[model samples]
Every structure is written in structure tokens, then in C-alpha cells.
Target chain A: MSGQQSTTSTSIGSRLLDWSLRGYVVLVFVFIFAPILFSVVFSFNSARFPTIPLESFTLHWYQTIWNDPDVWTAVRNSLIVSVCTALIATLLGFCTAYTDYRYNFRFKSAYLALVLLPPTIPLIIMALAMLAWFSKIGASGQLWSIIIAHSVLTAPFAMAIIRLRLNQMDRDLESAAWNLGASEWRTMREVIVPFCKPAIVSALFLTAAVSFDEFAISWFVSGLNKTVPVLILEIVQGNIDPQVNAIGTFVFLVSMTLVIVAQIFFTFRAGKSFS
Target chain B: MARTNFSGFATTWRMPIIVWQVLFFLGPLLFMIAMSFFLVKNYRMVEAFELKNWEKMLTRGYFWDSYILTFWLASLTTAVTSLLAFPASFALAFKVSPSVRRWALFFLIIPFFTSYLVRIFSWYVILAESGVVNALLAHIGLGPYTMLNTKFGTLVGYMTLTLPLVVVLQTFALANIDRNLVQAAHNLGCSPARAIYAVIVPLAKTGLIVAALFCFILSFGDFVSPYYLGGSKPPTLPILIIDTTKSGQQWPRAAVVAVVMMLTLISIAFAALALAYRKRASR
Candidate 1:
């Protein structure tokens, strides 16, 4: 529909558009990772302020956090909370997913909706509700309070991941196990669990990462039992410290490891299920 | 495997989780509502049904202003992030290879697992008056501008938080579209821009809208961006909730704000869900 000259002009224009799109994606990636890169790079900056012309690379800040007892306390608290939250959330998620897979009762839609509803609400409101409820029951300001809140926060995610795996599972495997005279418990342990192994592992890691990185709700309900993020917030509240960059670096590396591990397991299952 | 074991099986598997959600999730929500009506007698909540908390919070002009500001910032962030994410999503969905798409998704999703507080903090260094932006700008005699603790700073934080997520959601929705239609549009002498606006957007309208809705919901309820970055310039709703509790142990007043926020979110979610799924009239 175009003459040769016009076609060349359009092709050039389209080529320009293509390059810009690619460039835009690159810029986006740069923007997404810039703050992270800056924090990581400045963590070891011999200079105190996170400014340009960063001084010789040094581990002074990292060493500082290493010696800080408060930071250590936060690390311990976060570890216990994330690990406990992950296990509980995963177990609850598995049950919820299994319920969806195995049943077809009335109010099923409502049940599923409530299961997936937490992520949609803002964290501030949830934190408020959680804080009030915790206080009423004399459970506020404790490590377990954080765990309970985080489990509720993260279980839906675990349920979502496991539910996907359940949907992809071959229905016949379970029925076959049943026909072979395996008990329901036996079939669940042998057949369903194995099939969902990748998803379960992935969900555990993902939920752990989420609980580890979460801040607002943890801050409200964490009380004196501050997680790493809460500790970081206290440091950076009105002042700047290179210590935050060091702590941020540590938190960043840990969360990244958890998420990458989860991603690997998730994709491993995807490759298996599709092919 | 007994037929009569259905109830046992259902109860065994489902009841614990149902009870857990009801007790922890739903129970807290109900308590929050009730707590709003409880009397704050002698600086401690007492067992009384009163409207003082509601009256105190609702009658304040700052409360209403904060509510409006929160809504405005959230809506603005949604518009900005969605538009900003579109071109990258378009490229990822249509222009990139499968391997590239996979890598892009992985990279985009990484930020979500990282500390959002840190993400906002990263901007503080760059946007502050004596910060990196000004230092770089000194060469050209440009901005030593006031960027931090401003609306601009808050918007930047919101964008940083939502951009990666919106891009992931949009790319996912866009990638799932039927490509043949785009090819057909191309054959009918439509430009790439024209084809995207007319054909692709309508096909992916529901997903696009839902992604925007998520951006709005997250930004609306966010406390960190407005407090740390915006410097609480007349406090957004979430910031006000925090302040209320901090000032006088006004947990009841905070609960009132929380209830209002929840009601707003629920209604908005329902309306958006309806809008997303609404059918278009045929020509």
C-alpha cells in the first residue's frame, strides 16, 4: 500500500519506535534497580553520607551493625518470625487449597474470596485491626503476635501458589490411589503431597520472603520485638546513617536469596507441568 | 475412603483453616469496628458503646483533608504508573523473545520481595537538597532544587513501589492476547499505535483496569511514602491513623479511621470488579 520512498520512511520511523521501546525497558530496569544498587554500593562507602564521589570501599558500616546488639536482636526476632510464619502459613495454605480442590459446597466462592482477600486491603488498616485485637487479648508486644499477624498476611499467597499446582495436577492420580485401596490419608501423603512438592517448597520460600520483607504491619504489632525493617526504620526515622545501608544490604541479600530460590522451584514445576 | 467419612474428611481438612481465618482475620476486623465505638476512659479503652471516637475523628477538618489527599495521590499514582508501565509492557509482550520475557518477569518481580522502605529510602539520597541529583546538576548549573519531603518525592516513592508490579501485571495481560488480531489490524493498514489503542486495549481492558486498581489500593493505604518522603505535609489518612494512636493512645480513634478506610476499599474493590467485567455493547 506504499511507494518505495514512503515505505523506507515508515520503516525508519518504525525502527526508531522499536529502539525507543527497548531503551525504555532498559531505563525502567535501571530505575527499578537504581535505589537498590545505590544502597548496596553505598553500604561500604568509607564516606558517612551517601553522596557522590564515594570514598574508598570499606566494611566499616557492616562491622558497626555486626557489633550493634540491637541489630542482633532484630535479626534474631526476624528470623524466628519469618521461619515460624512460613511453616504455619504453608500448612494453612495447603489445607485451604486442598479444600478448594476436593470440595464443591455452597459458599465456596465466598470461602475462596476470603482466602484471597488479605492482599487487596491496605496494610495500614490491617495493622490497625491486628494491633487492636492483639492488645485486647493481652498478646500485644510479643514475638508470637508478629508471627500470627504475618501468617494471616501471607497464607493467602501460599494458598494461591499451591492452588495453581493443584489445578495442574492430574486428577486421575488421586483417584487411582484411592482405587488401589489407599486410605484418604495415605493418598494425601503419597500422591497429592509428592505432586505438589515443588509448589509447597516454593510457597514456603515465597511466604518467608514476604514476611521477612514486610514492614508496616510488623512495625505496629512487633512492639519491642522489632524485625530488621523496624530497626532500620528507627535508625532512618529523622536522620541518615550509613548503618541503614549496611543493614539494608544484608536484608536485601537475604530476601533476594529466598525469592530466587522460590522462583527456581516455581519454574521447575512450570517446566514439569507444561511438558 | 468411606462414603460417610465425607463429613469427617471435610471437617478435618477445612475446619481448622476456616476457624483460623475467622478468629484471626475476620475477628480482628470485627473487633476494630467495635473498638471504634468503645469509650477511651482515663486513657484506657473501657467497655462502653459510644460515638465519641467517631465524632472526634470525623468532626476534625484535618481528617477529611487527609482523606481527600490520600485519594487524590492514589488516583494520580495509578494514572502515572499505568501510563509509565505501558510502553515497556507493550515491548515485552509483543517485541521480546520468550527467554527475554521470562528474564524480564523475574527481574520485575525481584523488587516486590525487597524492602519497600528501602526502596523509598534509596530515593531520599538522590532527591534531597544536598543529594546526588544536586551534585550532578552543579556541573550544568541546574537543580539544587527542593525535591525531598515534597509531593514530588511522595509521587516518586509511589511510582517506585507500584511500577514494577504494574509492569508485571500489564505485560502478563498483554502477552496473553491473541497476536493474530494485531496482524490482521496491520494487514488492514493500521499503524502500530492505532492498532494498540483500538484493538489491543479493548481486548485487555479488564486486566489493565484491575492492575490500575491494585496500584490505587496500595498507594491509598501506604503510610511510609507519605510520612517519610512527603514529610507528612498535612498527613494522609494512614499517617493520621498512626499519629492518632501515637498522640494520646487514641487506639479507638485510629480504629475509626481504619474502619472508614476498610469501607472505602471494599466499595472501591467491588465497583472496580464490576467495571472490569462489564460487557461492551455490540456494534
Candidate 2:
């Protein structure tokens, strides 16, 4: 009878803990997501202040941003920069990671450290340095300059993801391809690139998102050609407009879609690779 | 010739990356440091070297205060983030189904993909005097107190911004724990809570430290949150550096702060690594 009672009490205790754990998780999710939900909701809010007494919904803000040419121009510039940056960063990152993984070389750790160092340095410092260096080289205040700067910032992240994927790959597959009279280039194109497709896709998504939304360096470097983020900064500093919220929500949705799509592709590929 | 050329191609794939890093990244960093040593006279950079900016930075009370505030806020954020992340990750790792966990992770990481500027600005909108938090408080016959431009506001922003990273890291770590060990503890009459605390935590110590260190460094260097949320009373280090460089064109002064910030981060990283190593050794 005593054993039965003890078991009952322990079961109750465990059940209570479980309820609290679920409750805590839900509360945290709400807290973390509150601002994002608010931003989306307020993008359609009729109120100009984005504050409450719960105003009626309207799509005026979105319409306003839609008709704004500056917003479009900024978006176009950002897209151009992001595409160029992602392509350059991903290709270079893959090459660097492949070299490091495929060969046994002296001072490899030191070289890898140099690759990782750019991201670790504070952004303001790097931006300031880049601005000065670019000006000295007569490359400041240009779109290409912004692209190069962003590439420097994002390439490390790409390299990290690619290197991790490379590390997990089967070396024997590559060796077998080589042994089957396949050229090195052929082996890489057929076996290696296909295997690393998920990482490369993820690299593209991540670097593009980073470049699209990068602010500090772009702010310093892109003198006349403003990216959407820099334009947002200008609006933010100038006025309190709901149109900013509308554009922000749009950017949020687009980037989220890209990441979600990439994540699904990656997870599926990773599942296949593991099996 | 074919063998030699193929070998050369194999090794030389690294050349473009090396050249790029050398010219753009390393060269600019060195240039910045060199610029910092030069004297600023009559609002122009003089070729002559001077330690005046460094002296000014070290001696200034404001600079020290900013450093202290940054460290305090970063530590607080790390603690708060870990407290919230650990339990959620535990629930995900053990309680939830694999399919649910995957989707949960997706939802968790989705917010981070948004423009960081917009994410920070959303807090400004949500925490304003008449905003959601305050409005809810007012409904309860409580505060319409200012939250938009305060240290508390900044803290909240940091917590939200860093949550996805902390949760992701901790979840990955928690998922890697050996299930048999947890089961063994249960068989040994250990309560679920005790098993998690005693068995799972020690095993996951390295990952936790790494995650904490990452949170600390990111929050410490963060200019966006503090700039938007933290009021102008006592600026954070990054804000100070940016203002100094932009307004005064004081490259050397800014560099001094940057160097200091870099050194502090490196030391903390080393210290955390040492602690992690010692913990393993003791085990």
C-alpha cells in the first residue's frame, strides 16, 4: 500500500513538471514572436502611429510603398548587390573549403583562421576600414564596392557551412571516381558538386540574405546608391511612417520564404545523405 | 606534364581566395590600424604617429562606463537567453516528436531571416509608450511607463534577437545526448528533473559554454539594439565608436576603442575555452 502511494505521488510530481515545461515553452515562443507578429499586423493597421486603441485594418501602407519609386530602386539595388555577392562568396568559399579539406598542407590552421577572422571583427571597425581603403583606391561610393565588401563579410559563413558538409562526405566515393578513369575535374563535377548541393544551396540563401540586409558597410560604402536597409534608416531617422512597416513586412516574408525553401531542401537532402 | 599540371590545379584552387582575403580583408584591417596611429591635426590626418587618441580613450571615464555597461548587459542577456532557451530545447529534444521538432526549429529560425534592422525597429514600435506592452499594462490599470528608449528596452531587444541562436545551439546539443544514459538514470530511481540536471547538463557543458560565448560576443559588439532601444544617456561602445568616427572623423580614437573591444573579446574567448577544458579534465 505504501509503495502504491509513493508511486502515485511521484507520478503526480512528474506530471506537474511536464505541464510547467510545456507552459514555459509556449510562453517563450510567445515572447520571442511578439514583435514579429506585431510588425506584420501593424503593417496593415490604419493608424499612422502604429499604436493602440486597436485601429481598423487597411492596406494603405502597402499601397503607399508600392507607388514609391525610391523603395523600388533601393530594392533593385539590394537585389543586384546580393546576387553578385552570393555568387562570388559561395564559389570562393567552396573552392577554399575544398582545398583545405582535400590537401594536407603546412599552416592550414592559420589559413583557416584568417578566413574566419573577418566575421569576428566588429562590423563598425571593418566598415570604417573598408570605407577608408576603398576611398584610397578610388572604389568608394560604388555598387561594386558594396558587393565586394559584403562578399568579404559573408564568405566566411559560406566557407564554414561548406567545410562542415565536406568533412562529413565519404572520401572513398571521390577516390573510386578517380580510380574508374574519371578525370579530377570530372570526379568533382559529377560526384563532389552533386553531393555538396545542399550546402551550396544553403550557402546561397544565407549569403544572399546577409548581403540583401547588410547595413553598416553598405551605409558607409554605397554613397549614392542606397540599399533598402539604408533607405529604411533614412526614413527611420526622418519620420514615423507606417509604410516602413509595410516594406519591412514584405522583406521579412520574402527572406523567410527563401530560408524555409532552402531549409526544406537541405533537410531532405541531409536525410537522404545520412541514410 | 599532365600529372604535374593536374597536381598544380588541385593545389592552386586556393589562390583566388588567398588573394581576395589578402587584398580586401587583411589589407584594410592593417590600414585601419595604421591610420589610427597617425595624428589628427586641424581636422585632417597627419602623417606623423601619435598615441594621443589611445591615451584619450583609456583615460576617459565615458569610455570605461560604456565598456562596463556593455559587459553587464551582455552577461545579463547571456543569462536570460540561456534560462529561456534551455528548457524549451529540453522539451523539444525529449518531449516532442521528430517531425514536430523539425517544424518547431523552422519556426524558430524563420524570424532571424528578416532584416535585422526591421527586427530591431519592430521592438521600438511594440514597446513604445502607447504600444502593445504599455497598452496591455494600461488595460490592467498599470503603467504607460516609457520602455522604448531605455536599458530595459535594450535588454528585451537583445533577448529576442539572440533567442533563435541560443535555442538552436542548445537543441542541437540536447539532441546529441545518449538516450541510454538518461534511461539508466531513470532505472536507478532518479527523477526526470534530477536526471536532466545531473546527467544531461554535465555532458552538454561544452556546447552550452560555446553557445554562451557566442551570445556574449554578438551582444557585446551589437550597435543596432543599443542604438535603437538604448537611450542616449550612456552610449554603448559601438555607438561611441561610430559617432566618433563619423562626426569627428577621429579614426585613431575609434580604432583605439575597436582594438580594446577586440582584445576583450579574444581574452574572454580564451578564458571560456580554458574553463571548458578544465571542466573536461576534472571529469
Question: For residues B33-137, what per-residue lDDT tens digits would candidate 2 score against the true structure?
Answer: 777677888988776577888888889999999999988999999998888799998988887789878888888877666777787788888888888789889
Instruction: State the displacement of the C-alpha of residue A89, model 2, in Å, after optimal TM-score superposition.
Output: 0.9
DockQ values of all predictions: 0.77, 0.63
| Among all candidates shown, the one with the greatest TM-score | 1
lDDT of 1: 0.89
lDDT of 2 at A88: 94
Specify the highest-lDDT model's number: 1
TM-score of chain A of each: 0.95, 0.93
Q: How far out, in Å, is residue A32 in model 2?
A: 2.4
lDDT of 2 at B56: 85
- Minimal lDDT window, size 10, model 2 chain B: B274-283
lDDT of 2 by residue, A68-162 (tens): 99999999999999999999999989988899889877888888887888876767778888987897788999999999999888898788878
